[model samples]
Target: MITQEKYRTTVKELLANGTIKMAIGYRPGSTPDRRRPLFIRTSEEADQLVLDSTCITNLSGYLVTEGLLSDEKQVGIFLRPEGIRSINILAAEYQLNVDQIVIFGFDSTGREVRPLQGRNAGDFSALLTEIKENPPLTSKEPLLERVEKMNAKERFDFWQEEFSRCIKCYACRQACPMCYCRRCIVDSNQPQWINTSSHTLGNFEWNVVRAFHLSGRCVQCGNCDRACPVNIPLRLINQRMAKEVVDGFDHFAGLSPTQEPVLASFKKDDTETFIL
Candidate 1:
């Protein structure tokens, strides 16, 4: 609650001084445990801001809305550490300019929400490095362990059963910050890449293609997992892919705005274990 009040005051000050044209934060939702995005452009709107442990949705995606930053005015946004990494990825891809953003970073443990001491993405370099060295325990949970221990055929069956439930709603893609493609291949008819219907085979192809696209770029924010209406374990697939890149290339996604994408760039000594 103290942190919440501090940010409200900060937003009000920034707006009063014309430091930012808008601020994106959270507000109470329909339920006690839910939160919705609040766009603050005035002092009265700043009063509606809510910052707490439940404010976990990555609000960075809203930064890419068309024409929002065309005027080049700064926009302040509430972000978690993962959200900061996302902006780095977006900047690296030329999706948005980091200079136009002012970060209000925060993270939480249990019910305690604490402010992170940084206003720009570059200011959090050391902290991001620390996170890359020691990732969160959620990445190594028992479910991922069980999937990793499965034989090839067992693993195929496992994911097949999960993919069978997909309804092709694309909620996972919509929720992901990394899926910024203006015209996704699934929607393309030029060459007709994958089956567009919601059959199990189509579902498998869609999910696989999306996972492959995010191989080395996912921040594991769990937005896709939470947004899946059918409750597919989308995080497991992305986490497995992220681990593969780190082990094979020593690459951690979103370390900086200029970091080369792991799969996009090639090196002479790149691992070729699967070449057989």
Candidate 2:
């Protein structure tokens, strides 16, 4: 409660002094455990802000909404560490200017909310590095382990069963911060790269392409996984791809705004063992 009030006061001060043009935070939803995005343009709106464990959505995606940052003025936002990572990736991809964002960062342990010590993405380098070094236990979760133990044919059967449930809704793409492409590959009809229907083959192709695109770029925020109405294990696929990059290229996504994308860069000594 004290932490929430402190941020509310800070947000009001920022708005009052014109330090920021707007703040993106959270507010009560239809239920107590739910939180909806709140955009604060004035001091009164700051009073409605709520910050806690339920504030898990990556609000960074809203920063990319058309014209929100076109005026080139500063905008404040509440961010967890992963949200900070999302913003860093956005800045790296030339989607937004990090300088124009004022981060109101926080994290939670169970239900206790705590403030992070940075107001800028660069300020949290050490924290992000620590996360890279010691990822969460969920990285080696039981479901992922079960999938990993399966033989190639069994693995194919498992995913075939899961992908069979897909309806081509594209909610996973919509929820992902990295999937900011204006016209997704699935939407292209020029050459028809992927089938538009929700058949099993089309579902497999779509999910595989998305995972490959996120190989060295996913922050593993679980947004796509949660957004899947059919409960596809999108996180597991993304995590496996992330591990491939870490193992093959020593790359960690969103480490810094200026870091080169791993798959896009090349070196003479790059491994070719998988070529065969």
> What are the models' TM-scores?
0.98, 0.97
Clashes of each: 0, 0
Tens digits of per-residue lDDT, candidate 2, 1-276, equal 888999999999999999999999999999999899999998899999999889988888899988999999999999988888888888988999999999999999989999999888899999999998998777448988899999999999999999999998999989988988888888889999988789999999999999988888898888888789999998899999988899888898888888888877978998998897
User: Which pairs clash in the backbone of model 2?
Assistant: none
Clashing residue pairs in candidate 1 (N, C-alpha, C atoms within 3 angstroms): none
Against the true structure, candidate 1 reaches a TM-score of 0.98
Candidate achieving the largest lDDT: 1
| lDDT string, candidate 1, 11-71, tens digits | 9999999999999999999999999999999999999999999999998889988889999
Looking at model 2, residue 165 earns an lDDT score of 98
Find the candidate with the highest TM-score and give its number.
Answer: 1
Q: Candidate 2: which stretches are off by over 4 Å?
A: none
